[model samples]
Structure formats: C-alpha cells, structure tokens
Target chain A: DTAVSQTPKYLVTQMGNDKSIKCEQNLGHDTMYWYKQDSKKFLKIMFSYNNKELIINETVPNRFSPKSPDKAHLNLHINSLELGDSAVYFCASSWTGATNEKLFFGSGTQLSVL
Target chain B: GESVGLHLPTLSVQEGDNSIINCAYSNSASDYFIWYKQESGKGPQFIIDIRSNMDKRQGQRVTVLLNKTVKHLSLQIAATQPGDSAVYFCAETYHLIYNQGGKLIFGQGTELSVKP
Candidate 1:
C-alpha cells in the first residue's frame, strides 16, 4: 500500500478560484504535515497536525488552511488562490512528532494557478 | 530566521564515480540532521541522518557526515548512477524545549546529475 497518498496529482485553476487538496496516510502515524515547494525547488513547511491537533503553523498566509479529520488524514484548502500559489504541495507523516523521526511523504500535488 | 543552504546548486559526475554534496546550516542548536533525495514528480525521500553526537553515519551506498563545529553537513554517494540523479537536500531540526516536535528546516538543495 502507498504509505502516504494525495489526490489531484495535477491541479490547474484560475487565479481567484478555490481548491482543496486531499491527503491520506496509511502508515498509522500520529503526526501529519503540509509542505509547499516553490519553482526554485525550495521546500517550506506550511502546517503540521499531531493527533488532529494543530502543532505547527508557519508564516503562511491565512488564505491557506489545513484540516485534519483524523491522525491519518490531513487536507489543505486554499481560498482565493493567487498566481504565486502555484507550486507543488506535499503531505507527510511520521510515527511521532519527534525531531529524529523519518517522514513518509506522498507523491505530491502539483498546483498551477494561472 | 536561521536556515540551511547548499554550497553547490548542481553537481555532475560520471557514472561509477563518487559524488559529494555539501550543505551549511546556521542553526548551531540543531541536534538532528537528515539528507533527502527528491526525483522528478516525487516528494523528498529520506536518505540518511546523523545526530549531533555522531560525526558520520552510513547506510547502503550512502553516507552522511555531520560537523557541528562548523555547522556543516555532507552526503557522500559511493557510486554515481543514473538512478542517483536527483536533487539532494539537507534538513536540520533542534529539540523544542518541553515539546515533542521541532520544525525541520530544509536547505536549498543540490541537484546531482550522473553523466553516462
């Protein structure tokens, strides 16, 4: 089974449109996270949820919100997306929210806002 | 905010040759460091990791070296293959006091090209 999976492998939407990316993990992990990778290939952490609780919230704008229905699933929702929002979004999970733990990442969702 | 960065943006090596990717981090308090390999249309994959107390750790054909004194990290690949052609990133995180999770900061990443 794929350890971590995210839907909409490719997303092309209008600049002002709203979209949501779904993520699920079958690794039985307690923590899940959302990351954004820009065109320069720079990866930045957007949000993290531990046991369905918000744990980490970076400097991301309020337009981007993360929802965790459970420990095994985390979803990202963007309202009024902009051209700068075009990038690859990744979902990851770890056994625990430990610094030394290795993260299992989903293939990724490529978002293109035109 | 402190960040991790790579010295080279791209590195090219012949097949069967050894390749080394270097990274520099500014967070001196970082106790855990990891290396990740990301290929086309894929998320980053964990390659190897090293703790502050250890200077070197090896796994399969990859080895990770950590130098806390200089705040440097390096990944050494024994044999360069086409399969190994991907972007490599070094990430570091320190323990948050009284917290279980710490934020992992990734470097700019160095793209390794294995020339056939």
Candidate 2:
C-alpha cells in the first residue's frame, strides 16, 4: 500500500484559476506537512499540521491555504493562482512532530500555471 | 537569514566510485540533520540522519559526517551505482520551543550522476 498519496499527479491551469490538491496518508502518523519545490529543485516547507492543528506556516502568499480535516488528510487549496505558483507540491507525514523523526513523502503533484 | 547550501550543484562519478556531497549551514543552533534523496519526477526520500551530539552515522551505503565547529555536513556514498543517480539534499532542523515540531531547512541540493 502507498504510505502517502496525492491526487492529480500533474496540473496545468491558466493564471487566476483556482485549484485544489488532495493528500492522504495511511502511515497513521500524527504530523503532516506540505512542501513546494521550485524549478531550481529547492524544497521549502509551506505549512504543517500536527493532529489537525496548524503548526508551521511559512511566508507563503494568502492565495495558498491548507486544511486538515483529520490527521490522515491534509488538503491544499489555492485561490486565484498566479504564474509564480508553478511548482511541484509534496505531502509528507511523520510519526510525530519531533525533528528526529523521519518523514515519509508522497510522489508529489506538479502544478503549472500559464 | 540562516540557510543550508551545498558546495557543488552537480557531481559526476563513475560506477563503483565513491562520491561525497558537501553542505554548509549557517545556523549554529541546528542540532539535528538529515539527508534526503530525490529522484526525477518523485518526492524527496529520507536516506539517513545524524544529530548534533554525534559526529558520524552510517547507513547501508551512505555515511553522514557532521562538524559542529564549522557547521558543515557531508554525505558520502560508497560504490556509486546507476540507481544512485539523484539529487541529494541536506536539511537542518531547529526545534521550536513554543511549537512541538521543528523547522527543517533544506539545502540547494547536489545532483549526483553515476556513469557506467
């Protein structure tokens, strides 16, 4: 079984169009995270939720919002996406929120805004 | 603006040769470090990790070395293989006192190409 899975492996949309990506993990982990990888392959953390509580929120734009209905699901919703939103989004989960815990990542969703 | 960066953006090595990727971190307070391997069209996978209390940690074919004085870390791969061709990233974690989780800062990443 896939530990972490995200839907819509690839997404192509025009600017100002809104889109949403869904993420789910069967690892039974308490913490989940959303990361964005740019064209340069630089991965940056965007948001994190621990047991359905918002824990980490980076300097991302207001267009990006993350909602976690439960610990096993964390979904990303982008409003009025811009060209700069083109990047690969990844979903990750860990047993706990501790730094020592290793994170299991999903395949990732490639988003392209034209 | 503390960040983790790599010395080289790309490294090419012959199969069966040893490969070393270097990373430098500016945050002295970072006590935990991890190495992740990312293949083309895939997300980053955990390879190995080392803590500030330890100088070195060894995995199956990977070794991580940490230098607290210079705030430097390195990942050494033994007997590089074609399957090892991927972008390697080094991340430093700083624990947040108020929050339960730690903030992981990733390096620019080094692409390793193994030629047979």
Candidate 3:
C-alpha cells in the first residue's frame, strides 16, 4: 500500500484560476507538510500541520493556504494562482512531530500555471 | 537566515564508481541531518540520516558523514548503479526547534548521473 498519496498527479490551470491539491497519508503520522519545488529543484516548506493543528507557516504568501481536516489528510489551496506557482508540490508526513524524523513523501503533483 | 547548499550542481560517475555529494549548512543549531534522493518524476526519498552526536552513519549502500566543526555534510554511495542516478539533497533540522514548528532546510541539490 502507498504510505502517502496525493491526488491529481498533474494540475494545469490558467493564471488567475484557483485550485486545490489533496493529500492523504496512511502511516498514522502526527505531522504533515506541504513543500514546493521550483524549476531549479529547490525544495521549500510552505506549511506544516500536526494533528490537525497549523504549525509551521513559512514566509509563503497568503495566497497559499493549507488545511488539515485530520491527522491523515492535509490539503493545499492556491488562490489566484500565478505563473510563479508553476512547479511540483509535494506532500510529506513523519511519524513524529519532530522535524528530525524521517519523512515519507508522496509522488507529488505537477502544477503548471499557464 | 539559515541555509543549506550543495557544493556541486551535478556529478557524473561510472556505473561501478562511488559517488560523493557535499553540502554546507550555516545553522550551527541544526543537530540532525538527512540525505534524500529524488527521481525525475517523484518526490524526495529518504536515503540516510545522521545526528550531530555521530559523525558517520551507513545504510544499505549509502553513507552519510557529518562534520559539526565545519558544519558540513556528505553522502557517499558505494558502487553507484544507474538506478542510483538522481538529484540528491541534504537537509538539516534541530529537534528543539519544534516550538517554531520545526523546519527541515533542504539544500539546492546535486544531480548524480551514472554512465554505463
């Protein structure tokens, strides 16, 4: 079974459109994260949630909002997506709340904003 | 202003040759380090990890070395095969930073290419 899975492997949208990416993890992890990988392959954390509570909110713009309905699901919603948002979005989960723990990542959702 | 950066952007090696990827971190507070491998169409996968308490840790065919003095980290792969070719990244985090939500800072990444 896939430990971590995210929906819509590919997302193609217009410049001003809004969209959401869904993520789920069956590992029974307490912490879940959303990361953005730019064209240069630099991965940066956007947000993190622990047991349905918002934790880390990097300096990401307010356009990007992460919502965790429970410990197993964390979803990212992009408002008025811009061209700069064209990149791969990854969902990850770690068994412990500490960042030092090993993380299990989903394949990723490739988002292209035209 | 914490940052982790790779020394090289890409490295090409023979199939049987070993590969080494180096990374430098600016955060002295980072007590834990990890190495991740990312394939073309996938997310980063955990390969190996090392804590500040230890200078070295070995996995199946991967080894991670940490130098707390210089705040440097390296990953060495033994008998690198074609399947091992991917973008490798080094990340650092501190356990105590959980109060700040605990973030893992990833380096730019080094692309390892294995040539047959």
Candidate 4:
C-alpha cells in the first residue's frame, strides 16, 4: 500500500489560472506537511497541518493556500498562478510531532505554469 | 534559523565503491537528523536517521555520522550501486510543538551519481 499519495502526478496550466493539488496519507500520522521543490531542487516547507489544524506557515505568497478537510487529507489551492510557480509539490506525513519521527513522502506533483 | 545545509551539490562515485555526503547545521536545539534520497520526477525517500544522543547510526548499507561539536553530519554508503544515484538531502528535525513530529529543515540536495 502506498503510505502517502498525491493526485494529478502532472499538472500543466496557463498563467493566472487556478489549480489545486490533493494529498492523502494512510499512515495514521497526525502531522502532514506541504513542500515545494524548486528547479534548484531546494525543498522548502510551505505549510503544515496537524490534525486538520494549521501549524506552520512559511514565507509563501498569499496566492498559495493550504486547506485540510480532515486529519488525513491536505490540499493546496493556488490562485492566479504565475510562471514562477512551476515546480514540484510534495506531501509528507509523520507518525508523531517529536523531532525523531521519520517522514513518509508522496511521489509528488509536477506543476508547470506557462 | 537555517537548520540544515550540505557542503556539495554533486558527488560522483564508481560502482562498487563507497560514498560519503556531508552536511552542516546550525540548530543546536535540533535533536534528530535524517537523510532522504530523491530521483528525477519523484519525491524524497527516507533513508536513515540519527538522534543527537548517538554520533553514529547504521542501516542496511547506509551509515550516518553526526558531530555535535562542529554541527556536522555525514552519510556513508557501502558498495554504492547504480540504484543509489539520486539527489540526497540531509534534514534536521526542528521541534516547534509538543507531542508531534517536528518540522524537517532540508538542505540543498546533493546529486549522487554512481558510474559503472
């Protein structure tokens, strides 16, 4: 079974369009996070949701919003996307909130804003 | 604070040889560290992790070493194979809350290529 999964492995959209990426985890983890991997392959945390509660909000633009409908699902909604929004988005889950828990990540969705 | 960082952006190794990837971090409060491997068109995969209490930890073919004095960490792979070729990242566990998984601060990845 896939521990962590994300929908729409590839997304291609024009600039100023709106899009959303869905993520789910069956690992029974309480903490879930959204990360953006840029062209340079630098993984940056955008948001983290713990038990459907927003916890960490990085320096991301307001156009990017993350919504958690439940403890097991977190979705990202992008508004008026720009060309620079093209990158890989990843969903991750961990068993606990401690510093020692290992994270399981999904395959990722490649978003291309043209 | 920027918690995790790597020393190199790429590392080339020969088949059947060993490989070592280095990282530096600044969070003294961080007590856990993990290494992840990511390939093209894929998300990051967890390799191994070590807690602050231990300086060294081992897995199947991977070994992680941590130096708290210099705030450095390294991952050593034995008999590196082609399948090991990927971008490796060192992540620090930054605790922000109680009774939860800490946030992972990932460093700039290092692409490892095992040439035959």
Candidate 5:
C-alpha cells in the first residue's frame, strides 16, 4: 500500500489558469507539508498543516492556498498560475513532533505552467 | 527569503568510490538538519539527519556531519552505486513554535552521477 499519494501526476496549463492538487496519507500522521522544487531543484516549504491547523505558512503569495478537509488529506489550490510556478510539488507526512521524524513523500505532482 | 544555496552544482563519482556532498547554511539558529535524496521523477527521500547537539550521525550507508562553528554540513556516501545517482539536497529545520516557526530550508541541490 502506498503510504502517501498525490493526484494528477502531471499538469500542463497556461498562465491564469486555476488548478488544484490533492494529497492524502494513510500513515496516520498528524503533520502534513507541501514543498515545491523549482527548476534549480531548490525545494521550499509552501505550507504545513498539523491536524487540520495551519501551522507553517511561508512567504508564498496569497494566490496559493492549502485546504485540509481532514487530517488524512491536504489539497493545494493555485489561482492565476504564473510561469515561475512551474515545478514539482510534493506532499509529505510525519508521525510525531520529534525533530528527527522523517517525512514520507508522495510521488509528486509536476505542474508546468505555460 | 531563500537560504543561500550550494557552491558546487554537480558531482560525479565512479562506482564503488566514496562521494562527499557539501552545504553551507547561513542560519546559526538551525538545530536540526537532514539529508534528502531525490531521484529523477520522485520526491526527496530522507537519507539521514543530525542535530546541533551531535556533530555526526550515521545510517546504513550514509553519514551526515555537522560543524557549528562554520555552519556547514556534509553528506558522505559509502561505495557509491549506479542506483545512487540522483540529486542530493541538504535541508535544515530551525526553532520556533512546535510546528509554526518550523520550516525545512533546502539547498539548491547537487547532482550525483555515479558512473558504472
């Protein structure tokens, strides 16, 4: 069984398009996170939710929002996508609050904004 | 703001050789560090991690070394294999709210080409 899974393995859209990526984890984790890997392969945290509570919100624009319907699911919505938004977005989950807890990653959603 | 990234962008090593990937972090407050490996089309996978209190941590075939004075970290791979060819990223976590102030800042990443 896949521990973490994300929808739309690949997405190709033009600028100004609004889209959403869904993520789910069966690891029964309380913490979930979103990360983006750019062309430079620089992975940055976009947002994180712990048990449905918005925890870490990076300087990402307001156009991008994350919604967690429940602790098992966290979805990302991007409005007015821009060229710079092209990259692979990853969803991750951890078991506990320990700093050493490794995040189990999803296969990732490759969003390419034309 | 983004963390200052890597100085070396790519590295290649012969199979069975040891590989060392280096990173420099600007934040002195960062206490927790992790090494992540990302293959061509997959998410970054955790390799090993070390805390500020400990200078070194070793896993099955990977080792992470941290230097507080220089704010530097390195990931050493033992007996590199073709399967090990991927992009290696160094990430750090800092102190703050249990989860709010916490963020994993990733390096630009170094491409590891394990030649067979």
Candidate 6:
C-alpha cells in the first residue's frame, strides 16, 4: 500500500485559473507538509500542519493556501495561478512534529500554468 | 537567513565506482541532517540521515559524514549503479522555539549520473 498519495499527478491550466491538489497519507502520521520544487530542483517547504493545526508557514504568497481536514489529509489550493506557479508540489508526512523524524513523501503533482 | 546549498550541480560517475556529493549549510544551529534521492516524476526519498552528535553514519551502500566545525555534510555512495542516477538533495532541520514543529531546509539538488 502506498503510504502517501496525492491526486492529479499532472495538471495543466491557463494563467489566472485556480486549481487544487489533494493529498492523503495512511501512515497515521501526526504532521503533514507541502513542498514546492522549482525547475532548478530546489525543494522549499511552503506549509506544514501538525494534527490539523497550522504550525509552519513560509514566505509563500497568500495565493497558496493549505487546508488539513485531519491528520491524514492535507490539501493545497492555489488562487489565480500564474506562470511562476509551474512546479512540482509534493506532500509529505512524519510521525511527529520533530524534524529529525523520517518523512514519507508522495510521488508529487506536476502543476504547469500556461 | 541561513540555507543549505550544494557545491556541484551535477556529478558523473562510472558504474561500480564511488560517488561523493557535497553540501554546505550556513546554519550552525542545525543539529539534524538528511539526504534524499529523487528520481524523475517522484518525490524525494530518504537515503540517510545524521545528527550533530555524530560525525558519520552508514546505511546500505551509503554513508553520511557531517563536519560541525565547517558546517559541511557529504553523502558517499559506494559501488554506484545505473539505477542510482537521480537528483540528490541535502536538507537541514531547523528548529524554532516559537513554532510547534521544526522545518526542513533543502539545498539545491545535485544530479548524479551513473554511466553504464
């Protein structure tokens, strides 16, 4: 069974369009995260939720919002996507809020804004 | 602001040879470090990790070395195979007393290519 899974493996939308990506984890982790990988392959943490509570929010713009209904699911919604939003979005989960713990990551959703 | 960065963008190695990827972190307070391998169309996979308390840790065919004095980390892979070709990233764990969970700061990835 896939420990972590995210939907819409590939997404292509026009500029100014809005989109959402869904993520789920069956590892029974307490913390979930969203990371963005740019074309340069630089992975940056955008947001993190611990047991459905917002714990970490980076310098991301307000256009991107992350919602966690529970500890098992975290979803990302982008408003008015722009060209700069083209990148791979990854979902990850960990056992606890500690950074030292191992993170299980989903395959990723490739978002391309035309 | 502190961040993690790689010294080389790409490294080419022959199959069955050893490969080394280097990373430099500016945060001296970082106590935990991890190396992740990412293949095409996939998320980063945990390879190995080390803490500030230890200088070196070994995994299956993989080794992670940490130098606290210089704030440098390296991942060494022995007998690299063709399947090992992928982008490898080094990340440092940053803790904030105000925040509930610590965050992971990732470095610019290093692409490792194994020539058959």
* Per-prediction TM-score: 0.95, 0.96, 0.94, 0.92, 0.93, 0.95
Q: Per-prediction count of colliding residue pairs?
A: 0, 0, 0, 6, 0, 0
DockQ, candidate 3, comes to: 0.65
Report the lDDT tens digits of candidate 4 across residue range B52-116. Answer: 99999999999999999988999999999999999999999766766443678988878899999
User: What docking grade applies to model 3?
Assistant: medium
DockQ winner: 6
Which pairs of residues have clashing backbones in candidate 1?
none
Candidate 4 lDDT for residue B41: 77
For candidate 3, write residues A1-114 as lDDT tens digits: 989999899999999999999999999999999999988888999888999998889899899989998999999999999999999999999986686698889999999999
For every prediction, compared with the true complex, DockQ reads 0.63, 0.67, 0.65, 0.60, 0.61, 0.69
- Candidate 5, overall lDDT? 0.88
Please state the interface RMSD for every predicted structure, separated by commas.
2.8, 2.7, 2.8, 3.3, 2.9, 2.7
- Docking tier of model 6: it is medium
Best to worst by lDDT, what's the order? 2, 6, 1, 3, 4, 5
lDDT of 3 by residue, B1-116 (tens): 11335344888999999998899886999988989999989899999989899999999999988888888899999999999999999999875543666789998888999999
Candidate number with the higher DockQ (1 or 4): 1
Q: Report the C-alpha lDDT of model 2 over A45-83, residue by residue, as the tens digit.
A: 999999999999999998999999999999999999999
Runs with alpha carbons beyond 4 Å of true place in candidate 4: B1-8, B97-101
Deviation of model 3 at A90, angstroms: 0.4
Candidate 6 lDDT over residue span B1-116, tens digit each: 12335443889999999999998886999999999999988999999999999999999999999999988899999999999999998899977786668789898878899999
Error of 5 at A4 (Å): 1.1
Q: In lDDT terms, which candidate is top?
A: 2
**How close to the true structure is residue B17 of candidate 1, measured as C-alpha lDDT?**
99
Per-residue lDDT of candidate 1, residues B32-107 (tens digit):
9999999999999999989899999999999998887788899999988999999998999988866547689998
**Could you tell me the lDDT of residue B26 within candidate 2?**
66
- Pairs with backbone N, CA or C atoms under 3 Å apart (clashes), candidate 5: none
Which window of ten consecutive residues has the lowest lDDT sum in model 5 chain B?
A: B1-10
Which one wins by TM-score: 3 or 6? 6
Q: Identify the runs in model 1 with alpha carbons over 4 angstroms from their true place.
A: B1-8
